[model samples]
Target: MGLEASNQGFIWVVRRNNNVNGGEEEKNEWLPHEFGKRMEGKGLIIRGWAPQVLILDHEAIGAFVIHCGWNSTLEGVSCGVPMVTWPVFAEQFFNEKLVIEILKIGVSVGAKECNRVVERIVKREDIKEAIRKVMVGEGALEIRNRAKKIKELATMAFEVDGSSYCNMQSLIHELISYNA
Candidate 1:
């Protein structure tokens, strides 16, 4: 239902890192193969892990479809990119809550179970609508601005006298005093 309706004026770019194993691999492999075939040429379907994909950070990537993993969320947030969260397991559900409810950056597809044989799933139309809803709406600009502010704050935190820097210095001094 969702996949079929998801793609319209948007391309679904998919990637999977090698670190995930077990049944997750079985599930992940099937999606890229199946969905990639459908989206090939029309969109992009990348397999394996590549840091260069972060370069998508600069392009006109209107939204991200992610698992709500913390690192992935941070990267997307750093890029000021919105997301369509589909949390698989672990703390991902909490992360999804933050992205959707707290950050107000994106949407969730709800807790829908999908199968391997399911064709025409999460298709072009749905993706197009989701993209439109995220990219063209009223709160998108505000969300983007807030994300940019967080990014700046993160940068500032590492500079001299910043909270993070001062904390590190305090830790070092404590260590030295203990050693003395």
Candidate 2:
């Protein structure tokens, strides 16, 4: 599956180090061997545990194929990178619902039978289409711009007169007066 997916020009960045016994070491060894052959001359970067990957920091990473984890969802939203949701289990379905229905920041795979480990393989065409939809389609640029505005607001909230900064100052003043 990895080989086939790689051949289709999609890099597979798997998160195999989360809460599983010896999973990190195993994935570190296996992932390179499994996906390395196809990586020659191709722009493929693999890592065992890079939480920031979902944050859309890489310019080349035009889209995210995620499992709908809440942290991952927020990171993606904060970064203004669009998503291609592939919910694996648990509340991921709900997260997908929010991304597609509420936020309109992404598209869901829409696979039924959420309990099964069906893999929910996505083809190359689907990936390309989703990338195009998020990066080039109508309203995509508007959504990205809105996300950028929100990110700027979050940054500003930590400045001297910002909401978080003022709250912290108030708390410190209260503590000092109490001590006095």
Please report, in order, the local distance difference test score of every candidate based on alpha carbons.
Answer: 0.66, 0.66
**Each candidate's TM vs. the true structure?**
0.64, 0.60
Q: Put down candidate 2 lDDT per residue, 15-36, tens digits, no spaces.
A: 5565446434444664545456
In angstroms, give how far residue 83 of model 2 lies from its true place: 1.4
Q: Once superposed on the true structure, which residue ranges of model 1 sit more than 4 Å away at CA?
A: 1-5, 8-41, 112-129, 175-180
In candidate 2, which residue pairs get closer than 3 Å at backbone N, Cα or C atoms, i.e. clash?
A: none
Give the C-alpha miss distance for residue 40 in model 2, angstroms.
3.4
> Cα RMSD for candidate 2?
5.2
C-alpha displacement of 23 in model 2, angstroms? 7.7
Report the number of the highest-TM-score candidate.
1
lDDT of 1 by residue, 1-180 (tens): 244344533444445444444332424645534655665555654455556336537666767777788998888876767777777667787898998888788877563433333332445555556555666667767766666676677678879999989999999999999989
